[model samples]
Target: MHDFIDHNLLARLSALPLESRQAMIGSVAGKHRSPHRGSSVEFAEYRKYVPGDDTRRLDWKAFARSDRFYIKEFEADTNLRAYFVVDSSGSMNFASGETDTKIQYARRIAASLSYLLVKQGDAAGLSVCNDKIHLEIPPSRSASQLQHIFNSLGELEPKGETGLVEALHTVAEKIKQRALVVILSDLFCDPEELGDALQHLRYRKHDIAIFHLLDRQEIDFAFDRPHRFVDLEDNSTLVAEPNLIVDEYHAALNEYLTKVEAKAHDAQADYQRIVTDQDYEAILSDFLTNRLR
Candidate 1:
């Protein structure tokens, strides 16, 4: 098992089924609802019978009530194909104290989720994005696919300026079918640009889930003395007295968070803002449980 795959966490979450909020279009019969009508037990809706419709699907009760022919439609069940988009930007290397680096945490989440998806007969894939989309593994249901994804995640490292926004746009254009697109990143890009990229995925009918990873120190700015902060992406340096700029820093952080949240809401993406100090298990558990609702 890879270091990112927590056996205990996997065991605990194994019973919680991963599900999609929207209907998917897949190639095989499975657990999730599909766009096309099929002979599933769950009732969808009824429509007036068409000449070429299956006669067995006709609802005699509906006919008796309205004196007109109607066809009973049931939701078609199909497999889900998911793509875990992980950011390998330089900013993702940050880790305060003993907590895992943002990129490491992302690896854990992506690997764990892909394991669960494949275990339940769904297809899972990976996209490692940094200055560009460095690698892309197409979704696959084969058991060996999990190992392949794990290997890719294990070798990934964070470097260079973030190109997450452009990478997302490319993903939106590349994926031809509806899929669950899970994103794990610090999301250090312009909120407006991020919003546009998210909207592109939404417009393509892909279900979006975002995990905005941040470190506690980055959020708290607890440094009491003057410190030199280096830009991980561009190698720029800033020497500032925390006392002098704490207020402005906080204000800017708050404004950024507000805009990001609003954009995510507007796109209807499932977004989770996480501090690195928190347990990833708890984070994932909450995410899985909420989708069950």
Candidate 2:
């Protein structure tokens, strides 16, 4: 395993408050607000108290006027489960520079997210998948377990073909409880296959977020000289002058991205395209803000 540490990146992320840091994973039990209201100190609303209502929660003042039982409802504090589905396929290893590979950036994202969740006392687990799902860590609120996740992430390498649909189906089957599933991948696969996988996850009522990782050069067709572009997974190569095909490539990429976004929307999942050149914190913050809404 090749371990590359970016202390500067970690330091920058560690400085942010837990809530502000994990805003992308959506609100869990921590700083993020959830849709479900429960019995907490924070008053949510007043409801008619039935016979089985807890006597402590009864609002006597309200009951006195109405001559009926009423209870004050407060938000409930509950632990949340977060799962990261990281792709370890060959395509994820693509990098234009030595300092940052797609997989490397993904590890950082996973680590930061795990740190935020653990800090907030939420159960966080990791499932590393390639052509098949290899590792499965059941969600738990253990700092040591999170450390294990980071260690495992460091060991992962890009290999084999991309079988996104198959892996997602397996994940949907294993996770019995509804959880926030964050998929980090380049998404270099057939749209139909990817759609089917997402649908399966949605059918199971899992909150899904797709982090579409890509290189800026790939998106912009910014290759400077004639070169042979190779498909990492298939070992297929094509040599051409990029300028001749740049327009068509951008058009195709844009169309594909649009279709992916549409599919995610239809599945009721959050989808964000992340370019390698952008700042991770900003990307995460934007996603979190959307999640909070």
Candidate 3:
């Protein structure tokens, strides 16, 4: 019943399967190709195609060599644990355009991914944080568990300062096994602190992905007139003319973003910058497309 996730979006996204670059220890036998070889249609190796073999998978080149057909065999598929770590800091509530707030859009992403994973027989978990962890749900494959994830996401209201560093470290410790950790946030935390926390997850061997959400106004610096700029986290205000400080602000923000991107690369994390005006479906599709089987 939640608007964050709907049948239509789920139906469309179900085609896009999630994959991990390294092997995953799935809780149950699922569709993803496992690192270990087994019985699946993923084409791990080739075998001589026989008389009864389906022609669809036959290799004509192999047949031409010795007049014998070959069939490709695949490794076994397994499920993966997907952890959605969402930032509930006040900054994520900003929305300068008609599109939804960063937090709202993030919720849709977390919810949709959870639905997709669960529908594919994989497990999905939820973690909400702002200065501290507010809610935590361990990964689960049960379809009924999605209601819990949706309810948690729906209840999140972005407020207070961010403690993303503390959050990432805490969640990394909680997960007992390697998992796909996806972080959705505005990333307004200290850059060094952020890097350290993400590195902690990397040390644990968790596959990390960071979604850096920014509102259009933040990205463009398109403000025209003087106005009171209020800090959402602390409710602090400053009256300033946009034309005067836009250049300086852009320079500082870009420098900070560059550092974050470099840190992510150093840590081998998939870093994606998402603008609030962009469609979530397309963003997610691009991210998932790279790892699909």
Q: For every model shown, what is its TM-score relative to the native structure?
A: 0.97, 0.84, 0.86
Sorting all predicted structures by TM-score, with the top scorer first, yields 1, 3, 2
Best model number under lDDT:
1
lDDT of 2 by residue, 1-293 (tens): 22444555546555453332121233345544344666656677888877887898888899789998888987555556778999999989988764378898888788777876677687788988888888888787887987788888988989888877788889898888667788999988888778988998888878788888998777777887899888888789999998798889889988999888888888888888888878887876666556542
**Collision count of model 3:** 5
lDDT of 3 by residue, 201-247 (tens): 99988889889999888888888899898999999999999999988
Off by over 4 Å in 1: none
- Model 2's alpha-carbon lDDT is 0.77
How accurate locally, in lDDT, is each candidate?
A: 0.94, 0.77, 0.86
Model 1: per-residue lDDT, tens digit, 186-246? 9999999999999999999999999999999999999989999998988899999999999
User: What does the lDDT read for residue 35 in candidate 3?
Assistant: 67
Candidate 2 vs candidate 3: the TM-score winner is: 3
List where candidate 2 sits over 4 angstroms from the true fold: 1-37, 42-46, 60-67
Model number with the top TM-score:
1
